[model samples]
Target: MNQPHTAQDDGVRQRQQQIAANLRALILSGDLRPGDRVPSTSDLVAEYGVTDKTVQRALAILKAERFVEGQKGRGVFVTTQVPTVVRASHYPVTSSEEPYAWIADNASRGRAGSIVLLHVGEVPAPAQVAAAFDLEIGTPVTVRHQLLSLDGEPVELVWSYYPSNVARGTRLAEARKIRGGTPAVLSELGYPPHHAIDQVSARLATVEEFIALRLPQDMPVLRQLRVVFTDDDRPIEVTVMVKAGQHFEVRYALPKPE
Candidate 1:
């Protein structure tokens, strides 16, 4: 049997929520600007007449939402929000206007962007992935997997899949960072990317992802399914991108209809 709700329980819950709301308001109001240190837990508890645990809980909420981050032996400081353009219909991959799409999107924003090669190998595609590639289920695809970081903090997980035939005997088959970018490699192979289709969705982060991104459990994430095609409309690449929800926003620029 379950116990019924009690006034005492309701009061405690409300108190916790109130503390969180008050701190969130302070941050949003610019009273606590980015990089500004939040009050010590003891200070907040005493000033708000709340328990130490209540103050901690409130801080935890802010941390999970990426509003503030705690440094060991130091104190919590407001975290800077990273503005990311997750999707741009016009910024095709082969634009080759930059070293790589990641660098253009992240490094140009004044944040150090980096990619750490995680895994690269030929793997059998899942049913949906095969369908996307117009191949039989379980067909082999070259998978280039890596982790993306911003300002030394892991923010995104990326995996680019290529048809085995298209990837064989190319630099994409190697487990090393591609020079320039993958688009450059594709162009060298005579099949430059022309345009792409992008789909974005949000979901709770998995345990592995929680550890990878140093994110709180139950925090939502943004997942992108991107397909890059050639001028002739041949799909050449499919990439899966998983990013921290608090760190990104997707925007699509549609061409004005004639």
Candidate 2:
């Protein structure tokens, strides 16, 4: 039987969430380094003015989300694997000299990154994808599904779409990997990307994402819908990117106000 919702339950849940948020902020801000021991449960309870049970629940949340681990007879410690910071404004100068821009970027950060082309074929455009392409809902489009990894661990899943008219008879529709990635192919086709806009959000992982990203739980994922536009303001490509939220954060470089 389902239990009735109550105000006390809501209060407890909010307090637990507050505790977890505080610890998460500290870890992400580098105030608590990897392998650093988190304060004891009794200490946290004292600090947060919550019961020991509430503190334990908050710690469990962190453990399930890969932020911390508990050791025998010892308190919780930050996991050795820390969150990766992605520079939102970085883009590769695509050329034969540097084909895989993403791999190169990760290399610069001292991490080995690679991509696996899981699928390439025609599919009915999803609602958002169709809208980006200025087509009616359920329009057909060429889609490429890829899984991106860092240090052999899955980090992101990407699905890129192109209108059939734009991608037909081109390498974009091919099942094999593109030598210079998609930007080079688009450029050669006279639709060089002039700019891109990204819409980002966070939500609990879907079943597919949980399995693909190997998430420890139904944790949140960072989702991005990016639309690339070329000369004449034509939408050339639409991409959906999903990353494990606990392990990734986007950083933007903002200009100073005049």
Candidate 3:
């Protein structure tokens, strides 16, 4: 039997959909640049004269679409760089499941999976990290840092963080033990993320990243930050992956407006 949506449910959905449309337009028109701060929930409520819950709904929708990402205490920001020309039909949905798989596949060809996991540990969360995970600052968090290689050549560096309480004693942590991908681990936690919001940008390689990727002084690197969310509209994970720009490319598949 088909059930009807309640008034409140309908209102929430409409507001969120509206927010998604407006946010997309802002990004595509370049009104919001990479790393630019987005309006806060309070600001949106005032500007749109909507309830706080309504604003949150909108932001949640944007997050699901990869249009914006929330930093722990850093609020949200426009994604840095998005490929201008790619349609949603260009690549398979699961083509690059892991954070760095896309660049690894393109740069290293059949060798993207050769990278080794360096350090994986649980530690106290920073202020920003805590906010992203909706936890108290100083809370314990699980952090995983890894290095990537291409045919024996180092090419990328990545750091991934998750709420320890949420991931501990679950398949998510077990998957990490087995070197399985984060998305799969998240699925085991009952929050299987099916979509991601990603932002890409370029910058001079940091001394640390340069040493890690073994890039020359003049080489730049690509930075990608992604937030993964469950279908029920909750944030699941956030990842930061960096790669040598000289050997990397970012691609996306956007659906054309009818």
Candidate 4:
């Protein structure tokens, strides 16, 4: 038989959740504006009739979610920065006419977007990457990895891969940021993206993700796999994207069967 919860344990959990809910509502409802200090533990405990630990637990939840930040020698305050909103790979790339496909999806929402190209080099393709690019595992592929940020806060990480033969002498092989974006260069190389397949999933964050995405160990990562194919159905590029789960909302639109 399954174990049953003890009344004492249940009561503790409810009280903690109740404190968290009250604080969360104040923060989200704009009553607690950014840069404003949260209630001190003593104040909260006395007001809620809960212990100090219970108040701390409630604040911890908000801290983990990045709803508030704690300062050294000072109390916790509402977060001043807003999370960046991003559209997933399923969203249409900025039209070719737009001139810079590297622009982020949040640009449509009037948020300033930036791509910081971190690395560029050839690495033996991993199994999933090889399969997506129709290359044998361990085959070398030119890779470009970057971090996307909005308003100076990171929003996502991307790893874009290209076949060695395809990028060997091209601009894609360079270790610097690409201007005019990937599609512009692809079009220059006669491999303009004509179609793409995007796959979305969730999983525990890797150590690198935990560090780079600045996510809590318990937070899941939102993963996006996008393979850009030429009109002839040849995969020219594959991009793997991971975002901090709480900071993103992924949406997709599907068509009716023909």
Candidate 5:
């Protein structure tokens, strides 16, 4: 048997919603511009005469709606209002191309940059990872993981994988030798990927990821997975990127048919 909600409980729920709506209006009205500082959780609790948990609930609602973003050790801020566009196409690498240079260029348009290279090494592929790359179980693969920063703050973490057969015995197999970029090395090996397919989703982070991303205890994350393919339809590489919900935007242009 379920207990019924009392009038007092209903009143509390209504108040929480009202608080969230008020904040939403302020953000949409240009009172809080992009990168503008928002009141701290403690301040919100005091100002609204609400408990800390209630204030956090309201903020969580705002975050899910994409109206605000939070930074580690930094208070929450009004997020830039930008439409997210994702390009679902392939980019062929040339001998002169750099693996992440193109992505870095794209980020530059949004004033973002790569910050940390967490881990890069060859390891036995996990079952799911091997399947994604069309490899047999236990095949060795080279994995390059990194965290990207925007304006000196961490924003996203990226994990890239390549089959050992594609990277083995090549300069790319050595982390130091190809530290500059991956596409350049792949191009040199005659496997220049020309196309990509990307998939996106939203979810909460795991305990380890939460700490690694430095996300707040209750915050969510956005996940993007991309598979790079050659013009001949051969799978060349796979990349998984996780972004803090507030600071990340995906942008692309739709082509008009002639």
Candidate 6:
């Protein structure tokens, strides 16, 4: 039989989570930048008014997630693998003279970005995707799944779907990385992306996501479902993007009033 939960156990876990959350925020905000030494255990214990075990447990959480590392005698320091901030609204605007937006975005940040096309085939649309494309449930759609990497580290898993008629004989249906990404190809086919809507959420990683991302644990993942529209407000594409929640953040810029 499973042991019953206790108040003492709950209290310890809460303290551990609190300490971890504070340190994680500091690392993500650049307050404790890469290579910066985390406060010594004694210092953290004093700051948080927690026991040594609590502090150690918190540090262990961060270490496992790759946020910090321990030196032989130097205590823990923030890792070089800082979380990536994604400029959500800007990365989709492609230029003919430059690489695809994702590549250019990473390149601008001095990181090597690459994409690997994992699979391509006709599949029945998922319910949400079907709604986005105005197709009935179980309607056929061409799906292309790819792995996106930054500095050779797997970052995001993306699945893009298009109406079968729109992708049947196009590069989007092929099992190869597109020269300019699908946005440019869609433009060539007269379905230029006019705009898009994105919905983002955070949840526990699915088994597939956990393995694909090589996560250290069953950590939360950010999922963004985007629907792209072309002329006449017709939906041309639906995409699902998944990223490790602890390693990525999204930014959106709002325009000021005139």
Q: lDDT values of the candidates?
A: 0.79, 0.87, 0.65, 0.78, 0.70, 0.86
Ranking by TM-score: 6, 2, 1, 4, 5, 3
Model 1 ranges with Cα > 4 A deviation: 1-52, 64-66, 69-78, 90-98
lDDT of 5 by residue, 1-258 (tens): 533422233454455665677787787666778898887876776667767788778887777666787888987888886423434454433434444664556565776555577777788887757877888877889888777765565667878889877777776666542433777677678887677778878898878667776774455688888888765888788888887765554656578998
Q: Write the per-residue lDDT of candidate 2 for residues 1-258, one digit (tens) a residue.
A: 533322233454478787887888899899999999998986776676778898998998888777899999887999987888886765556867768888987898889999999999999999999988889988999999999999998989999999999899999999998978899999999999989888889999999999999997666899988999999899999999999888798998899999
**Residue pairs in steric clash, candidate 6?**
none
Q: Which ten residues in a row have the lowest lDDT in candidate 4?
A: 2-11
Return the candidate ranking by lDDT, descending: 2, 6, 1, 4, 5, 3
The residue-by-residue lDDT of candidate 3 on 23-112, one tens digit each, is 767876678877988888877766666678987877776665456889998899876545323222222123334454444444543343
Pairs of residues clashing in candidate 5: 85-250, 85-251, 90-194, 90-195, 90-196, 92-194, 99-183
- TM-score of each model, in listed order: 0.75, 0.85, 0.54, 0.72, 0.66, 0.87
TM-score winner: 6
Every candidate's CA RMSD = 6.1, 5.2, 18.2, 6.3, 7.2, 5.1
Residue 73, candidate 5: how far off, in angstroms? 23
lDDT at 216, model 4 = 48
Off by over 4 Å in 4: 1-51, 68-85, 89-105, 256-258
Count of clashing pairs, candidate 6: 0
Q: Please, what are the lDDT tens digits per residue for candidate 4 over residues 1-258?
A: 533422233454467676766776786567998899998987777677777898888888888778888898999999975544445535345464554454645666667767788999999998888998877999999999999776666768999999989899989999887666777778889888888888889998888878887774356788988888986899999899998776776756666999
What C-alpha lDDT, on a 0 to 100 scale, does residue 8 get in candidate 3? 38
lDDT of 6 by residue, 220-244 (tens): 8999999999999999999999998
Q: Give the distance in Å from residue 186's predicted Cα in candidate 6 to where it truly belongs.
A: 0.6
Give each model's clash number: 0, 0, 6, 0, 7, 0
The list of candidate 5 runs beyond 4 A from truth reads 1-107, 110-112, 177-180, 252-258
- Please tell me which predicted candidate would have the highest lDDT against the true structure: 2
Looking at model 5, residue 83 earns an lDDT score of 28
